[model samples]
Target chain A: MSILEFSNVSFSNEGKSILKNLNIRIESRDYISIVGPSGSGKSTFLKLCNNLISPSEGNISFNNKNVSEYNPIELRKEIAYCFQMPHLFGDTVMDNLSFPFKIRNKKVDMDRIKYLFSLFSMDEEFIDEKVLNLSGGEKQRIALMRTLMFTPEVLLLDEVTSALDSENTLIVENIINKLNNEGSTVLWVTHNDEQSIKYANKLLTLENGEIKSLEVLK
Target chain B: MNSGATLSTSSLIIASSLVLISLFFSYYQKLNLEKETIIGVIRAIVQLTIVGYLLNFIFGLKNPFFTTLLLLFMTTNASFNASKRGKGIKNGFLISFIAIGIGAFITLFILVVSGAIKYEPYQIIPIGGMIISNAMVAIGLCYKQLLSNFKNKREEVETKLALGADILPSSIEIIRDAIKTGMLPTIDSMKTLGIVALPGMMTGLILAGTSPIEAVKFQILVTFMMLSTTSIASFLACYLAYKGFFNGRKQLI
Candidate 1:
């Protein structure tokens, strides 16, 4: 079943088109990697999936319902987006992690939080560390973990590991691959060809805000 | 009981010499302020003279209609100026007007009801002007800080939004910061009330021959009034201005 679908969608900003005539169906648990040059609307396309950027024409549907019909707050919870540069809020790592629950008026689950920390190969003690003092890779890892705390149906990643070293990149890649295997649909935008081919079950090549080709990778 | 004598024509002319002295210094230092200083001095003289006559006429009339109209004029001008700080937000003028109005009305209402100030031209007009002007500054700060914070921290806010957080919860920190920025000036001034500087109200009262202790009491009331004015204005402005950052679709504009 298709988890997400976009039909004849075109998004424009300030009289210029960002993504034009995008028609794609993302099946449940599909791992799709998008690759394109810098101005090709790669990030914008991912943003459209989460309804961050609405289309100028046509419609995007999530779960067979028009994306516009869904309340953005509820839609966003189901379709989470992680940016290339992790934007962490609050002082401590725990603060960032607990935000998902905090908004819902629920208490933080320390055991689950510890488990997520371990999943990112970080010790439980790191939760109390100030976000400002964390290294780049640690910040990215924590950001990704915070997004995962809600367990959304779809995960949209925009070059989340671009700034990480090779070792850190491998760790992120492994975690994402694990998430995909566990049945969450993942759409990742990457500039690196190797990472695109390695993780994606299907590789989508985008050019000039349009998908040039879709190829089966696995 | 006022100790200071009224300035005579020659005394006024002697004070006018201070402007000439400033003009001479500007010329000697090669500063371009000679023209600006001359124009500014002339403008101040003319404007103050006009306001003095106007106030005299209005106070003598003692009509509530004229008094209310004057207050409205002052508020309109103040809110218009305050709106400039919120250029990014739509309906900046209306938001400022409402915020400043609420702050001023509440504070002045309390003053009148408590019998601290009578609802007359002299008491209401001056006191209302001070309250409105301070509220205007606070609301302006709130608008400026809120818009800038939302712009700079877009990703941080959107990240929270993506996590199913409502708009209010998502931008809570920035909102808090904006309100803090608005309240900071009054808070700092209150902290150093007499030590750092003697405020205008106290100085004016002292010069008017009010006893020092009585002047102190009025100064304290002014400080408290300003504290109430600033905080209320900032909170109202922040609440109204934040909605402009997000659209109906819940996306940050």
Candidate 2:
């Protein structure tokens, strides 16, 4: 069975169509990179996968069950959604990072946090710094680290590295690639065409809310 | 210069002419408010005269049933007016009604139980009017604050939701801030009470032959009641109303 499937899904907001007739079957560990012009519904497609927004018509199933059937909190946790512009709340970085563990009633593992910091080339001591004083690149990385507090089954990234410098972008891309190699289904949306094809096994193009093409690159 | 404790009917009529000075100024200044000022003056006299007679009759009867009915009537009217501020929230009228009703009931119950005021028509009617009207204002402020916070902090709340937090936990910060916003005005007013100006009820009591000390004591009780009612109403209204900002999918509306 496919890990995620959208069967004839259509979405419209305020009576204007945004996405229509999106049919796709995602397999486990399949890294799918989506590329399109702005307003081609790339971000909308990623949001649908995380159950952040439901289809106005048709069905979306996660793990062979209708996505609506799973509790929204549980579905969002399993299919993590990282936004284009990162927003880090609370006073300190640790406040944002430990939120995932706080919600799940689980103890946060400092070792896992330190390990992610090492991968992202961030100092472990930066966790104590105020979130407001962090640079844009640092904030995005910290936001992504918060999302990764528990490794998700599927990671939905919508232009997650848009603010990052080349060096930081490379760090994020490599870390996400590492997560993909470890059996996480990845659906990433990027405007940078070169970056889209650099890491993913398959590439999908969206045009005016419809899938223009899907190619298995690997 | 009447020596009567109450103003004579002719003296009251003479006092009514004070509005013409307002009308003369409006006309002289080309403010275009002469008509409105005359209409407002006429309406005040008519409305207050009617209410005065009505209260006199009601106070004479001292019927608990009528007193409760009048309190409910005031609360319903207040709830309707307050709900107008809650434009975005679904079923705003119902939420305002419940919050204001509960706040008024809890405050009035305590006042009556403590013998601060009787359940009589004269005492409860005035006290209930003050509590319900204050609750209405507080609820309006809470609704506005909640709507603003949800709009301004959409991304922040969604960030929490996307990380698996439920709606309540996601909205807790906004809710607390909104309640604080609703209650802050009452707290500030209490700080400036006697120094800033004489409050309406205390001034009225002193002018109506109550001792200044007695009026001051009543004002203190009322100041305390306002603080209690506003906080309770704001807290309840915020909890009930925050859900309106989100949909069943746990997404912000």
Clashing pairs in 2: none
TM-score, second chain, candidate 1: 0.95
For candidate 2, the TM-score is 0.96
lDDT tens digits, residue span B109-132, model 2: 999999998899888998889988
Q: Model 1 lDDT vs. the true structure? A: 0.88
- Please report, in order, the local distance difference test score of every candidate based on alpha carbons: 0.88, 0.90
Model 2 alpha-carbon drift over 4 Å, by segment: B1-5
Best by TM-score: 2
TM-score for candidate 1, please give it: 0.93
> What are the per-residue Cα lDDT tens digits for candidate 1 across A71-167?
9988998899998889888989989999888877888888889888777777889889999999888888888898998788899998889778998
